[model samples]
Target: MKTFNVPIIYRSPLISAIKQQRKQQDKMKKDFTPTRLEFGPLTILLARHFGFCYGVENAIEIAFRTVEENEGKRIFLLSEMIHNPQVNSDLLSRGVRFLMDTSGKQLIPWESLQPEDIVIIPAFGTTLEIEARLESLGIAPLKYNTTCPFVERVWNKAEQIGGKDYTVIVHGKPKHEETRATFSHSRSHTPTIVVKDMEQTHRLAAYIREEAPAEGFYEEFKGQYSEGFDVTKHLGRVGVVNQTTMLASETQAIADYVRQAIQEHYQLPDDRIAERFADTRDTLCYATNDNQTAVTGMLNVEADLAIVVGGYNSSNTSHLVELCEEKLPTYFISSEEKLISPKELLHYDFHNHEELRSSGYLPQKENITLLLTSGASCPDAIVEAVIRKLAGFFGLEHLVDETAAAWA
Candidate 1:
């Protein structure tokens, strides 16, 4: 794996040392166990895989390097460089403005951009229409494009199957930038439709099974299908791809469901199932899978609560919180600043899209055990700060430095 020249502010001496040691011990990355950190009373089980992934590091490196190399010139991002608040704020502080919000709403007019100005495509990429719009403005969209290779892999897979007349079934949040970009790319090659989850997939399968009227498909799947999509014509052959950040297991389940539907509809045998369903294997990135698996592994051990650190809007982070919530109480926070005191803390409820404060988050006990982890875009520095804050509450703050020094 290639590394990026990320800013030092995002780095953590303790985290780097721990990760290096873990990597040395498990070169194959077969272990999903958490790293145990003991501080007399409070013990933290840190997820084996968490924080800045390859795509995020690469995007940050490009954004920062572009700012340094092109001083005095305006640099505009298509949207946020990544989902992390700290990273986006850092870029904003460096005078890198955004032309649109994450939902594709225009913040700045396209006419304001000059031919000499630079526009950066974020890791989530952009829609084909936006790319053409930028081209018309004389700005090269791909020149500073930080689109992750794994995401492009999904697009390539879609195109490959689309060439063979397979209708692409995208598993993702429809309003997501990556999904919009992927839908645009796949629809250009063949018929494409976006399904958010198994519930929506069930609804889509009704049409595939011909149990529902094709005319009702338009009203049921409004804005989810590509232009000129005919459910009757396209549902015969299909393939599944995902947003790369969604739950990998969920994506696989949806694919399995769709394949089974196609099999039942066509009365195809196991060997002949491929005749109806294109075998588009899991499209999730390595980081999302590893992190989610690590959480599952961590849950095997008993714990009081789980603390997930990352931007609230981050899709990967919410899925991490979702996994933890199934097993135990989970708090999603962006930084240590959310720890208002030892007695109370502020946390984001992603389901409700609101922040709420709660008392007695920490269990009243002699010895405490908790789980801690972050998202792909979260900086290790934020995780370290969160650990230090918890340590201070237990009056074992010095032990954190000692542990880091020992790891160092």
Candidate 2:
């Protein structure tokens, strides 16, 4: 676990102390229990694993460092460095412009990019085509590349399975930059397709079993499948990989469903399963698994509601909100500003893609219990600010400083 020299604005002494103390106490990380921050009337059940992950930290360090190292040069990001709004805004404020949006929509034309201009490949990575396009401009895409190691690991896994003649079935959002990049890389080695969820996986299973017409697969899958992808030929052997930020369990479930389909389609024996289905569980991301499992463990305790902090459009953050919403009232917010007050809160309804204003969000009671966590891309400063805001509601904001000092 290599640490990065992330900007101080993104760090928090209080959260850092809490995390360090927890890490020291649980070296093995077997303890999934939340850290109970007792603040008289407010009991904050901070999740064991949350906030910025290794990949995000690495990206932040690289992006900011690139800015510092290249003062006079024009710098451009292929897309967002990470999903967090604060980090992206910070980069933008520093004059690091984006060439494309998250959906691969071009913001600045490729023709405008000069050979001397610096181009940064974001943490989500870019397609081989995009890489080629950058190279054509005489810009070294790899020099300022900040693609997360875990994402590259997934690509490597996809390539490995593809080399063995297995079609790569990517479990991720179809329009996601990472998935598109992965599809491009995998399709180059072998055929690849993107499945957003189990529903898509089930639809794909029909093709795998030859229960659906091959021509229909083209229309059904549409933009999801690779060019020159023959449903009949490619569906025979497959492997599952995912966008590192996607829900790990759903990816596994899709893989299991696809594997079962392949098993039954070929009527393969126990040991012969690998002949049709490639083992690709290794592609599941460590940070995604840890964050989700930590949420599961955190949910074991009874809390009034959960507050998830992160970018509204963040895939990883949305999944965390989804997990929390299943168990209790969960409010998805980008930062502490969404807290509004004790009685009223503004949160994002990710499913609907809109913000909702809610009253009586904090229960009317003497003592309040809350489960708090953030997405992998969220800054600790944001989480600490959230805690401080919640504490201010009870007039126990001083306790936060006291706790931090004690921990210090």
Candidate 3:
């Protein structure tokens, strides 16, 4: 809980009430619900945990400081500092350039970099090969490194598990920067493979059961498995870890599936199964856990429609949308601009992976309740903007002023 001086913008009375309720909840070790305020036509339900996470705050602080301290020097980011577009655009406007894109495509030629140029390693971290390349070009990766400590902890766990002579099964999107970094680091220690989801895990289990030909393994997991990975040999002893932001329940299910597959295949009892598969707990970050738990709490209350605010590419934000869509109508929008009107709204449907327009999203009920939450990289100021937009839709902008005045 290292505190940093990050500004939080919100309606003062609402923020104060939320803080008080959080304190009470902490004391009681139970969920706390603040009394709903009369803010015109909409009743906003703020989540207990949302917005910028520790990693995001640390990255922002370090990036802004780099800009302030090294005046006139060209500062290049290894990639987008975080997933949020506004944050990345702001850094770009400040003369920061990106060396690579999210897909690991080189935006700037590595040879162009000089010893004097400052290159900031992103929070997702860079592969060892990339690090070595930077070092060769006289760019010290450690000085401007913003890799999250939690992610590094996962890599360390992978190394420790690998040291025990077990193969590593990483439960995450293979193409994600964090996953790529972890896989590269883990492969150096032991054999590693990435499973995208339960579907892939089921296929892996079938492969472990020897129902599929061993030759298919190479073709099926061509780029995902480490070099010289033999399915028959590697699946014997394995340990499971995950990207820090994966859906918690899904990761647990994948681990359970792998453990059961190994047990049945080897005809080992519960005690003996531990020798083959390490029952590692989930590696999901704290912000993800808290925000997901809070979403569960929000689901206890009935709401007409849910507004999930954050970058569409953000894994945590998409999870929030997933949680909400299971029970209620959910709109995943990046900012207030998506709040086009009470009748129409534009949003990204993560399931379809496309932008869509929905009309008449607001319920006709006299008292409208909204479950509001944002991704870890989202700024609180954007959440405030969303609230103001909703207020304007209801012709209740005065309520925000009143709430601020009450706190003053």
Per-residue lDDT of 1-408 in model 3, one digit per residue for the tens? 695655343223455555556656586436634224457679888787787788988888888889989999989999888888888988898899999998899999999999999999888877888889989999887899888888898899999999999999999889888899999999999999999999999999988888889899888887999999999899999989998888888888999999999999999998888789986778888888878888888878877888899988888899889998999999999999999998999999998889899998998878898888888888877877788889889999778767655644
Give the candidate number with the greatest lDDT: 1
lDDT of 2 by residue, 233-300 (tens): 99999999998888877888898999999999999997999999998875756788888889999999
Candidate 1, residues 133-217, lDDT tens digits: the string is 9999998879999998889999999999999999999999999999999999999999999999999999999999999999999
TM values, all candidates: 0.99, 0.99, 0.95
Badly placed stretches (over 4 Å) of model 3 are 7-17, 24-37, 404-408
Per-candidate Cα lDDT values, in order, are: 0.94, 0.92, 0.85
Ten residues in a row with the worst lDDT in model 2? 281-290
Residue 106 miss distance in model 2 (angstroms): 1.3
Evaluation by lDDT, superior candidate among 1 and 3: 1
Candidates 1 and 3: which is better by TM-score? 1
Off by over 4 Å in 1: none
